[model samples]
Target: MILETFKHFPDFELLDSGNGYRLERWGAYRLARPDPQAIWEHQLADAEWKKADAIFNSKWQVKTSVSQPWPIRFPLPLKAGEAKTGEWSIKLLARLSTFKHTGIFAEQAANWEWLTEQVQNTEFKAQKEQLKILNLFGYTGAATILLAKLGCFVTHVDASKPAITWAKENQIANNLPNDSIRWILDDAAKFVKRELKRGAKYDGILMDPPAFGHAPSGRTWKFAEDFPRLLADCTELLSTNAKFLLVNAYATNSSAIALQNLLEDSIKKTGTLESGELCLKQNSGRLISTGIFGRWSK
Candidate 1:
């Protein structure tokens, strides 16, 4: 499996990288933010960083338009703080704007294209048979929407109400069939346990486990301590003719080798395993390893 490859991102650019930070352009917004992973030194002038529309402090927020009256301090709501608006179009009720994000991990684009092809080519002989796919930790539902667009009956699970709501808004914005997907706001592990108890099975499963996060009710999810058990239980939830299982990790504790080892120990025992790191090419044409991904297929 290829861990890092040169992939083209038509709409995004990694403008600069240095000082434990990165300058990025998404659609029409230019942002400067802290990226612990970007350890390189800046090759550009200081003026370049000053030109960002927004800069991150302890957290993220919008920068006042240079032409507008500058407020002494900007007080933004939590959700608003994490978002940035640009001229770009999005699939959510939230106005079509460049998001606070640098464009959805640009590296995951490869996975998106791969999965779409997989679902499109794999056929089930049963009449009225539909591919049952599940996406855990589905942040904004980009993959969920994409899979649904390809005729999969997707169940998208996330613990954050706003995130789920955002995903739903994106689905609606895209005019997706209301019946094509199911949105659930619950702890992913807990939901999987319940699904197992209910004897539910999925043909395909995708998960992007966060390095550290908490559920709505304060349930902590520390990937290192929990992922193994989670993966073990998830294997039980796969159907007899399961198509694929994908796991993506971005935390420092979760390396490409570690993820591959876990998949080999867990899913490989049941089927074939494929794994690698996901990477992005900066504007300077440098490859940046962003995340790790693994897959198992029967």
Candidate 2:
């Protein structure tokens, strides 16, 4: 809560943007993808844009046959340990999908970092056991792997089977213990309700819900209608000392203020509440706002 409102994934870069597209460098590959935020004129030359390894116009266009999966590693703060040279890190498997995603949301890198910081600070010396964290709408598990690496036991819930499988691969990629993460392939709201019924509680909870989607069981999740109900359910599921709760949204009508208000209204606990836009800083020192986020922590 004491850092910049805008942050980005150090491993990724937004190279240029314009014409409803953004050119990005993910690890070593350059990609051009459609972005609603790129409403201005092109900042880079066409020649420069021609170097993209892949360009998406409803699909990928590349010069050569592309690999299936690649690694994008984020260095972690070195833990208290014996080795000096070896640093802790986690890697997300990157792949070009039909939906034009590389299996990770680059903008969420900040929230992942912030969540870790909040948990670390809140845990203090009082809590010794591994914290139980719930990750709803857990996509490819970037935060899941990162947090689990810090020794948290995470329950990752998502409706998509493919997403859960990819997240499992990411877990293995990090070499985390098998019991570190509980992979649950179920609708997020339904799963949360079940957890509430089971009297389950979490030390922390984080969710990145879609603007609109359908659960695997064909239940609809409309941001305007469902988010508040989900938040109410989540409030009851948190541990009393709940170390953290993060909500990221890309809904059309949301702002940081709106997110803050929602969080403030949902939970009765007293904690630090911070909200801001999720943004990507381009090489030219410009920031492209992607989504809004609000987080609470003890």
Give TM-scores for every candidate, taking all chains together and pairing residue i with residue i.
0.81, 0.93
The candidate scoring highest on lDDT is 2
Candidate 1: worst-modelled 10 consecutive residues by lDDT: 69-78
Clash pairs, candidate 2, are none
Query: What TM-score would candidate 2 get against the native?
Result: 0.93
Clashing residue pairs in candidate 1, if any?
3-277, 86-98, 91-170
Error of 2 at 212 (Å): 1.0
lDDT per residue as tens, model 1, 1-298: 6756434344557788888888876545567877778888887789988888777766555674532211111111112223545422323222212333532455676777667656755656235688999899998787887778666899999998877776787787667889999999999999999999999999999999898878878989999888888898887888887888989888647777788888887774466677788877676776677888888776
Model 2 off-target regions past 4 Å?
1-8, 79-85, 124-127
